[model samples]
Target: MSKLIFVNLPVADLPRSIAFYEGVGATKNPQFSDDTAACMVVSETIHVMLLTHAKYRQFTAKAIADARTTSEVLICVSEDSRESVDARVSAAVSAGGTADPTPTQDFGFMYGRSYEDPDGHIWEVMWMDMAAANEAMACEGAGQAA
Candidate 1:
């Protein structure tokens, strides 16, 4: 069986978070959702659990960090191409997210951009060509060793 990843995020507004995630291409899975939480499926193996602030407190005693003011985590996902990465960021912005909370990264082989959700959680979208990246790294290594 393939291992799946479920990224649990505390959201101030469950419905709004659901809409934002959906806007960025995640599908809501009603079977695992309720008024206090939502299951947003990003892919066959990636799932995002959006929990209301109150509902999230049930899992931990620590106070939830105000995502807008403090950085706790930066989540990243890969797209198939550079265009897709840009499209995802654009969608996020359209859905109330703030685009480019961080600087854009464009190494010839890899392209990436980030957006902050309404709750201020950052999600980075990136695309890379592994073959090209490996070739570049190998050449750099050889040059350094010379």
Candidate 2:
């Protein structure tokens, strides 16, 4: 069987977080959702559990760091193209996220941008052309150019 991943994150408001995720094109999995948490389906094998701060604390003894002041984690997702990256970042902004001031660009090999959600969680959207990367690596191997 294929492995599945569940990314659990703390949210100040469950309903607001659900709305924000919905605005950015994620669907809720009712079968795994309840009053304290909502399950957002990112893909067939990936699920994001948006848990209330109070409930989330029960899972860990360490104090929860305020995401606004300190980053707890950075969730990165890959897209098909740079345009798709920009579109997703734009969608995030429209859904109450703030884009990072600078975006990372590595000359056709890879590109990425970051956004801060209302609760201050950081998310990075990126695109990498493996074909281009392989070709560049081949050139490097021959000691010619990128």
Candidate 1 TM-score over all chains jointly: 0.97
**C-alpha RMSD by candidate, in order:** 0.7, 2.2
- What lDDT would each prediction earn against the true structure? 0.95, 0.86
Residue 27 C-alpha lDDT in model 1: 99
Per-residue error at 33 for model 1, in Å? 0.4
Cα RMSD for predicted model 2? 2.2
Relative to the true structure, candidate 2 reaches a TM of: 0.90
- Residue range 1-146, candidate 2, lDDT tens digits: 87998999999989989988887778999999999999999878888899998889899988878999886888898888899888888988898888873466557788888888789888888898899889988988889643
Clashing pairs in 2: none
Worst 10 residues of 2 by lDDT: 99-108
